[model samples]
Target: MKLKITVLFIAFISSLTIAQTKVGTIDSEYIIGMMPETKKVVEITKSYGAMLDSTFSIRVTDFKVRLEDYKLKEKDMGELEKKTIQKELAGLEQDIKKYQKNGNTLMGLKRDELMRPLYTMLSEAIAFVAKENGYTQILTITGNEFAYIDSKFDITELVLKKLGITIPKG
Candidate 1:
Protein backbone atom coordinates (compact mmCIF):
# COMPACT_ATOMS: atom_id res chain seq x y z
CA MET A 1 0.00 0.00 0.00
CA LYS A 2 2.85 2.42 0.80
CA LEU A 3 4.62 1.74 -2.51
CA LYS A 4 1.35 2.23 -4.39
CA ILE A 5 0.70 5.58 -2.67
CA THR A 6 4.25 6.75 -3.52
CA VAL A 7 3.80 5.81 -7.16
CA LEU A 8 0.42 7.64 -7.29
CA PHE A 9 2.03 10.81 -5.78
CA ILE A 10 4.85 10.70 -8.33
CA ALA A 11 2.39 10.31 -11.19
CA PHE A 12 0.36 13.29 -9.98
CA ILE A 13 3.46 15.49 -9.75
CA SER A 14 4.59 14.45 -13.20
CA SER A 15 1.16 15.19 -14.61
CA LEU A 16 1.24 18.67 -13.09
CA THR A 17 4.62 19.36 -14.68
CA ILE A 18 3.37 18.18 -18.04
CA ALA A 19 0.31 20.42 -17.78
CA GLN A 20 2.37 23.58 -17.17
CA THR A 21 2.08 25.97 -20.07
CA LYS A 22 4.31 28.95 -20.84
CA VAL A 23 2.49 31.62 -22.81
CA GLY A 24 4.06 34.74 -24.31
CA THR A 25 2.71 37.78 -26.16
CA ILE A 26 4.17 39.72 -29.02
CA ASP A 27 3.08 42.87 -30.90
CA SER A 28 4.23 42.08 -34.41
CA GLU A 29 3.27 45.52 -35.66
CA TYR A 30 5.50 47.14 -33.09
CA ILE A 31 8.38 44.91 -34.09
CA ILE A 32 7.77 45.60 -37.79
CA GLY A 33 7.62 49.33 -37.22
CA MET A 34 10.96 49.19 -35.44
CA MET A 35 12.58 47.31 -38.28
CA PRO A 36 14.92 49.21 -40.59
CA GLU A 37 13.28 47.69 -43.69
CA THR A 38 9.98 49.31 -42.79
CA LYS A 39 11.44 52.73 -43.57
CA LYS A 40 12.12 51.67 -47.13
CA VAL A 41 8.63 50.27 -47.46
CA VAL A 42 7.19 53.52 -46.18
CA GLU A 43 9.25 55.55 -48.62
CA ILE A 44 8.35 53.37 -51.59
CA THR A 45 4.67 53.45 -50.69
CA LYS A 46 4.77 57.22 -50.36
CA SER A 47 6.38 57.58 -53.77
CA TYR A 48 3.85 55.29 -55.34
CA GLY A 49 1.01 57.22 -53.69
CA ALA A 50 2.43 60.48 -54.98
CA MET A 51 2.61 59.12 -58.50
CA LEU A 52 -1.01 57.96 -58.35
CA ASP A 53 -2.08 61.30 -56.93
CA SER A 54 -0.32 63.21 -59.67
CA THR A 55 -1.87 61.09 -62.42
CA PHE A 56 -5.35 61.51 -60.92
CA SER A 57 -4.78 65.21 -60.47
CA ILE A 58 -3.89 65.65 -64.10
CA ARG A 59 -6.99 63.77 -65.26
CA VAL A 60 -9.19 65.85 -62.96
CA THR A 61 -7.63 69.07 -64.17
CA ASP A 62 -8.14 68.11 -67.79
CA PHE A 63 -11.77 67.24 -67.09
CA LYS A 64 -12.34 70.58 -65.42
CA VAL A 65 -10.76 72.49 -68.28
CA ARG A 66 -12.85 70.66 -70.85
CA LEU A 67 -15.97 71.22 -68.74
CA GLU A 68 -15.30 74.93 -68.55
CA ASP A 69 -14.72 75.11 -72.29
CA TYR A 70 -18.00 73.29 -72.96
CA LYS A 71 -19.93 75.58 -70.65
CA LEU A 72 -18.47 78.65 -72.34
CA LYS A 73 -19.30 77.40 -75.86
CA GLU A 74 -22.72 75.85 -75.12
CA LYS A 75 -24.61 79.08 -75.88
CA ASP A 76 -23.06 79.36 -79.33
CA MET A 77 -23.32 75.67 -80.26
CA GLY A 78 -26.27 73.93 -82.06
CA GLU A 79 -28.56 71.51 -80.15
CA LEU A 80 -26.94 68.37 -81.60
CA GLU A 81 -23.44 69.71 -80.97
CA LYS A 82 -24.40 70.58 -77.39
CA LYS A 83 -25.73 67.05 -76.79
CA THR A 84 -22.55 65.57 -78.19
CA ILE A 85 -20.38 67.72 -75.93
CA GLN A 86 -22.49 66.79 -72.91
CA LYS A 87 -22.08 63.08 -73.69
CA GLU A 88 -18.34 63.49 -73.99
CA LEU A 89 -18.20 65.26 -70.65
CA ALA A 90 -20.24 62.49 -69.01
CA GLY A 91 -17.92 59.86 -70.44
CA LEU A 92 -14.87 61.70 -69.13
CA GLU A 93 -16.45 61.92 -65.66
CA GLN A 94 -17.15 58.20 -65.61
CA ASP A 95 -13.64 57.45 -66.78
CA ILE A 96 -12.18 59.55 -63.97
CA LYS A 97 -14.28 57.69 -61.38
CA LYS A 98 -13.23 54.33 -62.78
CA TYR A 99 -9.58 55.34 -62.84
CA GLN A 100 -9.74 56.51 -59.21
CA LYS A 101 -11.24 53.23 -58.07
CA ASN A 102 -8.75 51.14 -60.00
CA GLY A 103 -5.85 53.23 -58.73
CA ASN A 104 -6.90 52.59 -55.12
CA THR A 105 -7.05 48.86 -55.75
CA LEU A 106 -3.63 48.90 -57.41
CA MET A 107 -2.16 50.80 -54.50
CA GLY A 108 -3.51 48.25 -52.03
CA LEU A 109 -2.05 45.41 -54.07
CA LYS A 110 1.29 47.19 -54.23
CA ARG A 111 1.35 47.72 -50.49
CA ASP A 112 0.68 44.06 -49.81
CA GLU A 113 3.29 43.02 -52.32
CA LEU A 114 5.88 45.28 -50.73
CA MET A 115 5.10 44.17 -47.15
CA ARG A 116 4.74 40.41 -47.67
CA PRO A 117 8.40 39.60 -47.21
CA LEU A 118 8.73 41.83 -44.19
CA TYR A 119 5.77 40.15 -42.54
CA THR A 120 7.28 36.74 -43.31
CA MET A 121 10.56 37.75 -41.69
CA LEU A 122 8.73 39.08 -38.64
CA SER A 123 6.76 35.82 -38.34
CA GLU A 124 9.94 33.77 -38.49
CA ALA A 125 11.58 35.93 -35.83
CA ILE A 126 8.57 35.61 -33.54
CA ALA A 127 8.60 31.85 -33.93
CA PHE A 128 12.32 31.67 -33.20
CA VAL A 129 12.01 33.80 -30.09
CA ALA A 130 9.08 31.81 -28.80
CA LYS A 131 10.89 28.53 -29.29
CA GLU A 132 14.12 29.80 -27.77
CA ASN A 133 12.26 31.08 -24.73
CA GLY A 134 10.33 27.82 -24.28
CA TYR A 135 6.96 29.35 -24.96
CA THR A 136 4.20 26.81 -25.40
CA GLN A 137 1.98 29.41 -27.03
CA ILE A 138 2.58 32.88 -28.40
CA LEU A 139 -0.37 35.22 -28.86
CA THR A 140 -0.35 38.33 -30.98
CA ILE A 141 -1.65 41.50 -29.34
CA THR A 142 -3.05 43.46 -32.24
CA GLY A 143 -6.21 45.48 -32.88
CA ASN A 144 -8.93 45.14 -30.21
CA GLU A 145 -8.92 41.39 -29.58
CA PHE A 146 -6.48 41.50 -26.68
CA ALA A 147 -7.86 43.67 -23.90
CA TYR A 148 -5.23 43.02 -21.25
CA ILE A 149 -1.81 41.39 -21.12
CA ASP A 150 0.74 41.29 -18.32
CA SER A 151 3.96 43.11 -19.00
CA LYS A 152 6.01 40.14 -17.91
CA PHE A 153 4.58 38.00 -20.68
CA ASP A 154 5.38 40.53 -23.43
CA ILE A 155 8.12 39.31 -25.74
CA THR A 156 8.16 42.12 -28.32
CA GLU A 157 11.57 43.33 -27.37
CA LEU A 158 12.87 39.82 -27.21
CA VAL A 159 11.68 39.21 -30.74
CA LEU A 160 13.29 42.41 -31.99
CA LYS A 161 16.52 41.42 -30.31
CA LYS A 162 16.33 38.00 -31.86
CA LEU A 163 16.03 39.70 -35.26
CA GLY A 164 19.20 41.68 -34.51
CA ILE A 165 17.27 44.92 -34.07
CA THR A 166 18.42 47.36 -31.41
CA ILE A 167 15.73 49.18 -29.54
CA PRO A 168 16.20 52.89 -28.98
CA LYS A 169 16.41 53.94 -25.32
CA GLY A 170 13.92 56.59 -24.43
Candidate 2:
Protein backbone atom coordinates (compact mmCIF):
# COMPACT_ATOMS: atom_id res chain seq x y z
CA MET A 1 0.00 0.00 0.00
CA LYS A 2 2.80 2.46 0.89
CA LEU A 3 4.68 1.60 -2.32
CA LYS A 4 1.61 2.46 -4.39
CA ILE A 5 1.25 5.83 -2.58
CA THR A 6 4.94 6.60 -3.07
CA VAL A 7 4.69 5.83 -6.84
CA LEU A 8 1.75 8.21 -7.23
CA PHE A 9 3.59 10.99 -5.37
CA ILE A 10 6.63 10.58 -7.60
CA ALA A 11 4.51 10.68 -10.74
CA PHE A 12 2.82 13.93 -9.59
CA ILE A 13 6.16 15.63 -8.97
CA SER A 14 7.53 14.44 -12.31
CA SER A 15 4.59 15.93 -14.13
CA LEU A 16 5.22 19.32 -12.52
CA THR A 17 8.88 19.21 -13.47
CA ILE A 18 8.12 18.20 -17.05
CA ALA A 19 5.66 21.05 -17.41
CA GLN A 20 8.41 23.57 -16.64
CA THR A 21 10.74 22.42 -19.43
CA LYS A 22 10.98 24.91 -22.32
CA VAL A 23 12.29 23.64 -25.64
CA GLY A 24 13.63 26.08 -28.20
CA THR A 25 14.76 25.31 -31.74
CA ILE A 26 17.12 27.41 -33.80
CA ASP A 27 18.44 27.05 -37.35
CA SER A 28 22.06 27.91 -36.59
CA GLU A 29 22.98 27.47 -40.23
CA TYR A 30 20.52 30.16 -41.18
CA ILE A 31 22.04 32.52 -38.65
CA ILE A 32 25.52 31.75 -39.87
CA GLY A 33 24.46 32.22 -43.48
CA MET A 34 23.23 35.71 -42.73
CA MET A 35 26.48 36.79 -41.11
CA PRO A 36 28.78 39.00 -43.19
CA GLU A 37 31.77 36.95 -42.07
CA THR A 38 30.49 33.92 -43.98
CA LYS A 39 31.28 35.54 -47.34
CA LYS A 40 34.95 35.92 -46.47
CA VAL A 41 35.17 32.32 -45.26
CA VAL A 42 33.60 31.07 -48.50
CA GLU A 43 35.97 33.10 -50.62
CA ILE A 44 39.08 31.96 -48.73
CA THR A 45 37.98 28.33 -48.79
CA LYS A 46 37.41 28.44 -52.55
CA SER A 47 40.83 29.94 -53.11
CA TYR A 48 42.46 27.28 -50.98
CA GLY A 49 40.59 24.55 -52.86
CA ALA A 50 41.73 26.04 -56.17
CA MET A 51 45.32 26.02 -55.01
CA LEU A 52 45.09 22.33 -54.11
CA ASP A 53 43.51 21.52 -57.46
CA SER A 54 46.25 23.35 -59.38
CA THR A 55 48.99 21.42 -57.56
CA PHE A 56 47.21 18.12 -58.14
CA SER A 57 46.81 18.90 -61.82
CA ILE A 58 50.52 19.61 -62.20
CA ARG A 59 51.42 16.36 -60.39
CA VAL A 60 49.10 14.34 -62.65
CA THR A 61 50.56 15.94 -65.78
CA ASP A 62 54.11 15.03 -64.74
CA PHE A 63 53.08 11.47 -63.95
CA LYS A 64 51.41 11.08 -67.34
CA VAL A 65 54.49 12.45 -69.14
CA ARG A 66 56.83 10.08 -67.26
CA LEU A 67 54.63 7.05 -68.02
CA GLU A 68 54.39 7.97 -71.70
CA ASP A 69 58.17 8.39 -71.97
CA TYR A 70 58.72 4.99 -70.31
CA LYS A 71 56.27 3.25 -72.68
CA LEU A 72 57.93 4.83 -75.74
CA LYS A 73 61.51 3.90 -74.68
CA GLU A 74 60.92 0.44 -73.09
CA LYS A 75 61.42 -1.47 -76.41
CA ASP A 76 65.07 -0.32 -76.71
CA MET A 77 66.02 -0.79 -73.01
CA GLY A 78 67.46 -3.93 -71.30
CA GLU A 79 65.30 -5.79 -68.76
CA LEU A 80 67.10 -4.21 -65.78
CA GLU A 81 66.63 -0.65 -67.10
CA LYS A 82 63.00 -1.39 -67.96
CA LYS A 83 62.34 -2.72 -64.47
CA THR A 84 63.90 0.37 -62.87
CA ILE A 85 61.74 2.77 -64.94
CA GLN A 86 58.62 0.69 -64.25
CA LYS A 87 59.33 0.77 -60.52
CA GLU A 88 59.87 4.53 -60.63
CA LEU A 89 56.58 4.96 -62.53
CA ALA A 90 54.78 2.76 -60.00
CA GLY A 91 56.14 4.89 -57.16
CA LEU A 92 54.99 8.06 -58.92
CA GLU A 93 51.49 6.60 -59.42
CA GLN A 94 51.26 5.83 -55.71
CA ASP A 95 52.40 9.33 -54.85
CA ILE A 96 49.77 10.84 -57.12
CA LYS A 97 47.00 8.77 -55.50
CA LYS A 98 48.21 9.75 -52.03
CA TYR A 99 48.35 13.42 -52.97
CA GLN A 100 44.76 13.34 -54.32
CA LYS A 101 43.52 11.87 -51.06
CA ASN A 102 45.51 14.32 -48.95
CA GLY A 103 44.25 17.26 -51.01
CA ASN A 104 40.63 16.48 -50.07
CA THR A 105 41.56 16.23 -46.39
CA LEU A 106 43.50 19.49 -46.55
CA MET A 107 40.53 21.29 -48.07
CA GLY A 108 38.29 20.14 -45.25
CA LEU A 109 40.80 21.22 -42.62
CA LYS A 110 41.13 24.66 -44.19
CA ARG A 111 37.35 25.16 -44.30
CA ASP A 112 37.00 24.14 -40.69
CA GLU A 113 39.83 26.44 -39.71
CA LEU A 114 38.16 29.43 -41.40
CA MET A 115 34.71 28.69 -39.95
CA ARG A 116 35.81 28.08 -36.36
CA PRO A 117 35.56 31.70 -35.24
CA LEU A 118 32.13 32.18 -36.83
CA TYR A 119 30.87 29.05 -35.13
CA THR A 120 32.19 30.31 -31.83
CA MET A 121 30.32 33.58 -32.28
CA LEU A 122 27.12 31.75 -33.13
CA SER A 123 27.50 29.50 -30.07
CA GLU A 124 27.87 32.50 -27.80
CA ALA A 125 24.76 34.10 -29.28
CA ILE A 126 22.80 30.90 -28.78
CA ALA A 127 23.90 30.72 -25.16
CA PHE A 128 22.92 34.32 -24.53
CA VAL A 129 19.53 33.82 -26.14
CA ALA A 130 18.91 30.65 -24.14
CA LYS A 131 19.67 32.36 -20.85
CA GLU A 132 17.74 35.54 -21.57
CA ASN A 133 14.60 33.78 -22.77
CA GLY A 134 14.54 31.09 -20.06
CA TYR A 135 14.91 28.32 -22.61
CA THR A 136 15.67 25.12 -20.68
CA GLN A 137 17.11 23.52 -23.80
CA ILE A 138 18.07 24.83 -27.18
CA LEU A 139 18.21 22.66 -30.30
CA THR A 140 19.84 23.29 -33.67
CA ILE A 141 17.65 21.34 -36.04
CA THR A 142 16.63 20.81 -39.62
CA GLY A 143 13.01 21.74 -40.30
CA ASN A 144 12.15 18.23 -41.56
CA GLU A 145 12.62 16.63 -38.12
CA PHE A 146 9.30 17.94 -36.75
CA ALA A 147 6.04 17.73 -38.67
CA TYR A 148 4.95 20.87 -36.96
CA ILE A 149 6.78 23.38 -34.77
CA ASP A 150 5.38 26.61 -33.38
CA SER A 151 7.23 29.64 -34.75
CA LYS A 152 7.14 31.28 -31.32
CA PHE A 153 9.44 28.56 -29.99
CA ASP A 154 12.00 29.08 -32.78
CA ILE A 155 14.80 31.17 -31.39
CA THR A 156 16.68 31.69 -34.68
CA GLU A 157 15.62 35.28 -35.01
CA LEU A 158 16.41 35.99 -31.39
CA VAL A 159 19.91 34.65 -31.81
CA LEU A 160 20.33 36.50 -35.11
CA LYS A 161 19.13 39.68 -33.52
CA LYS A 162 21.58 39.19 -30.72
CA LEU A 163 24.32 38.60 -33.24
CA GLY A 164 23.39 41.86 -34.99
CA ILE A 165 22.92 40.25 -38.38
CA THR A 166 20.92 42.41 -40.75
CA ILE A 167 18.48 40.34 -42.69
CA PRO A 168 18.68 40.95 -46.42
CA LYS A 169 15.60 42.51 -47.93
CA GLY A 170 14.09 40.45 -50.64
Candidate 3:
Protein backbone atom coordinates (compact mmCIF):
# COMPACT_ATOMS: atom_id res chain seq x y z
CA MET A 1 0.00 0.00 0.00
CA LYS A 2 1.09 3.61 -0.50
CA LEU A 3 0.95 4.32 3.28
CA LYS A 4 3.21 1.34 4.07
CA ILE A 5 5.80 2.48 1.46
CA THR A 6 5.82 6.02 2.86
CA VAL A 7 6.33 4.72 6.43
CA LEU A 8 9.19 2.51 5.32
CA PHE A 9 10.86 5.40 3.51
CA ILE A 10 10.61 7.62 6.58
CA ALA A 11 12.09 4.89 8.79
CA PHE A 12 14.97 4.44 6.39
CA ILE A 13 15.70 8.13 6.37
CA SER A 14 15.57 8.27 10.17
CA SER A 15 18.01 5.40 10.42
CA LEU A 16 20.40 7.10 8.01
CA THR A 17 20.31 10.33 10.05
CA ILE A 18 21.01 8.41 13.24
CA ALA A 19 23.91 6.55 11.63
CA GLN A 20 25.55 9.69 10.26
CA THR A 21 25.95 11.51 13.55
CA LYS A 22 28.47 9.79 15.81
CA VAL A 23 29.24 11.91 18.86
CA GLY A 24 32.06 11.03 21.21
CA THR A 25 33.38 12.57 24.41
CA ILE A 26 36.97 12.97 25.55
CA ASP A 27 38.48 14.24 28.80
CA SER A 28 41.41 16.36 27.67
CA GLU A 29 42.61 16.95 31.23
CA TYR A 30 42.67 13.22 31.83
CA ILE A 31 44.55 12.64 28.59
CA ILE A 32 47.08 15.36 29.33
CA GLY A 33 47.65 13.98 32.83
CA MET A 34 48.52 10.57 31.42
CA MET A 35 51.19 12.00 29.17
CA PRO A 36 54.82 11.66 30.35
CA GLU A 37 55.67 15.05 28.92
CA THR A 38 53.32 16.69 31.42
CA LYS A 39 55.42 15.47 34.34
CA LYS A 40 58.58 16.76 32.75
CA VAL A 41 56.97 20.14 32.14
CA VAL A 42 55.88 20.35 35.75
CA GLU A 43 59.38 19.54 36.97
CA ILE A 44 60.99 22.09 34.69
CA THR A 45 58.53 24.77 35.76
CA LYS A 46 59.11 23.95 39.42
CA SER A 47 62.88 24.32 39.02
CA TYR A 48 62.46 27.63 37.28
CA GLY A 49 60.11 28.79 40.04
CA ALA A 50 62.66 27.77 42.67
CA MET A 51 65.34 29.81 40.94
CA LEU A 52 63.06 32.85 40.95
CA ASP A 53 62.26 32.31 44.60
CA SER A 54 65.97 32.14 45.47
CA THR A 55 66.73 35.35 43.63
CA PHE A 56 63.86 37.12 45.35
CA SER A 57 64.91 35.79 48.74
CA ILE A 58 68.47 37.05 48.26
CA ARG A 59 67.24 40.48 47.27
CA VAL A 60 64.90 40.62 50.27
CA THR A 61 67.73 39.60 52.62
CA ASP A 62 70.03 42.23 51.16
CA PHE A 63 67.35 44.87 51.61
CA LYS A 64 66.76 43.81 55.22
CA VAL A 65 70.44 43.88 56.05
CA ARG A 66 70.91 47.29 54.49
CA LEU A 67 67.84 48.69 56.28
CA GLU A 68 69.03 47.41 59.65
CA ASP A 69 72.50 48.86 59.10
CA TYR A 70 70.97 52.19 58.08
CA LYS A 71 68.79 52.26 61.18
CA LEU A 72 71.78 51.59 63.44
CA LYS A 73 73.83 54.36 61.74
CA GLU A 74 71.03 56.89 61.44
CA LYS A 75 71.54 58.37 64.90
CA ASP A 76 75.11 59.30 64.05
CA MET A 77 74.44 60.47 60.46
CA GLY A 78 73.51 63.91 59.02
CA GLU A 79 69.91 64.73 57.86
CA LEU A 80 70.95 64.45 54.13
CA GLU A 81 72.51 61.05 54.79
CA LYS A 82 69.29 59.79 56.40
CA LYS A 83 67.16 61.10 53.51
CA THR A 84 69.43 59.44 50.92
CA ILE A 85 69.26 56.09 52.72
CA GLN A 86 65.48 56.33 52.89
CA LYS A 87 65.29 57.01 49.15
CA GLU A 88 67.60 54.08 48.40
CA LEU A 89 65.49 51.74 50.55
CA ALA A 90 62.32 52.88 48.77
CA GLY A 91 63.93 52.21 45.40
CA LEU A 92 65.00 48.70 46.52
CA GLU A 93 61.42 47.96 47.65
CA GLN A 94 60.07 49.01 44.27
CA ASP A 95 62.67 46.83 42.52
CA ILE A 96 61.62 43.82 44.58
CA LYS A 97 57.94 44.35 43.71
CA LYS A 98 58.79 44.73 40.02
CA TYR A 99 60.85 41.54 40.04
CA GLN A 100 58.07 39.56 41.70
CA LYS A 101 55.52 40.72 39.13
CA ASN A 102 57.85 40.03 36.19
CA GLY A 103 58.81 36.62 37.56
CA ASN A 104 55.16 35.55 37.66
CA THR A 105 54.63 36.73 34.09
CA LEU A 106 57.77 34.89 32.91
CA MET A 107 56.64 31.67 34.60
CA GLY A 108 53.25 31.85 32.87
CA LEU A 109 54.92 32.42 29.49
CA LYS A 110 57.36 29.55 30.03
CA ARG A 111 54.56 27.18 30.96
CA ASP A 112 52.61 28.07 27.81
CA GLU A 113 55.74 27.73 25.67
CA LEU A 114 56.50 24.28 27.04
CA MET A 115 52.93 23.02 26.87
CA ARG A 116 51.98 24.21 23.38
CA PRO A 117 53.65 21.36 21.51
CA LEU A 118 52.25 18.77 23.88
CA TYR A 119 48.75 20.19 23.39
CA THR A 120 49.22 20.18 19.61
CA MET A 121 50.25 16.52 19.69
CA LEU A 122 47.23 15.62 21.78
CA SER A 123 44.93 17.52 19.43
CA GLU A 124 46.33 15.64 16.43
CA ALA A 125 45.84 12.29 18.12
CA ILE A 126 42.26 13.17 18.97
CA ALA A 127 41.57 14.25 15.41
CA PHE A 128 43.10 11.10 14.00
CA VAL A 129 41.08 8.89 16.30
CA ALA A 130 37.89 10.75 15.49
CA LYS A 131 38.47 10.47 11.77
CA GLU A 132 39.48 6.81 11.86
CA ASN A 133 36.47 5.90 13.93
CA GLY A 134 34.07 7.95 11.77
CA TYR A 135 33.18 10.29 14.56
CA THR A 136 31.47 13.47 13.38
CA GLN A 137 32.13 15.39 16.56
CA ILE A 138 34.27 14.91 19.66
CA LEU A 139 33.30 16.94 22.72
CA THR A 140 35.52 17.68 25.69
CA ILE A 141 34.09 16.49 29.03
CA THR A 142 36.89 17.94 31.14
CA GLY A 143 35.20 21.15 32.27
CA ASN A 144 31.67 19.83 32.80
CA GLU A 145 30.79 20.84 29.28
CA PHE A 146 28.18 18.11 29.09
CA ALA A 147 25.57 17.49 31.73
CA TYR A 148 25.07 13.87 30.74
CA ILE A 149 27.10 11.50 28.57
CA ASP A 150 26.91 7.73 28.30
CA SER A 151 30.14 5.97 29.18
CA LYS A 152 29.99 4.03 25.93
CA PHE A 153 30.43 7.29 24.01
CA ASP A 154 33.71 8.16 25.72
CA ILE A 155 36.67 7.74 23.35
CA THR A 156 39.35 8.94 25.76
CA GLU A 157 41.08 5.58 26.02
CA LEU A 158 41.03 5.20 22.26
CA VAL A 159 42.67 8.60 21.89
CA LEU A 160 45.40 7.66 24.37
CA LYS A 161 46.02 4.41 22.55
CA LYS A 162 46.23 6.26 19.26
CA LEU A 163 48.94 8.49 20.72
CA GLY A 164 50.91 5.39 21.85
CA ILE A 165 50.29 6.40 25.46
CA THR A 166 49.20 3.51 27.63
CA ILE A 167 46.18 4.09 29.81
CA PRO A 168 46.91 3.42 33.46
CA LYS A 169 45.26 0.22 34.57
CA GLY A 170 43.04 0.54 37.61
Tell me, by lDDT, which candidate is best.
Answer: 3
For model 3, what is the error of residue 35's alpha carbon versus the real structure, in angstroms, after optimal superposition? 0.7
lDDT of 2 at 38: 97
In model 3, pairs of residues that clash are none
Candidate 2, residues 31-145, lDDT tens digits: the string is 8889999999999999999999999999999999998998899899999999998899899999999999999999899999999999999999999999898898987785558
In candidate 3, what are the lDDT values of residues 1-170, reduced to their tens digit?
A: 99999999999999999999999999998989999999999999999999999999999999999999998999999999999999999999999999999999999999999999899999999999899999999999877756679989889999899878987677
> How many backbone overlaps does candidate 1 show?
0
lDDT of 3 at 79: 96
lDDT of 1 by residue, 26-140 (tens): 8888888989999999899999999999999999999999999998998999999999999999999999999999999989998999999999999898888888888889988
| RMSD after Cα superposition, model 1 | 2.6
Off by over 4 Å in 1: 1-20, 145-147
Please report the candidate that would top TM-score against the real structure: 1
- What is the alpha-carbon lDDT for the whole of candidate 2? 0.91
Per-prediction RMSD in angstroms?
2.6, 3.6, 2.3
| Residue 145 local lDDT, model 3 | 59
Alpha-carbon TM-score of each model against the true structure: 0.88, 0.85, 0.87
Predicted structure 1: lDDT: 0.91
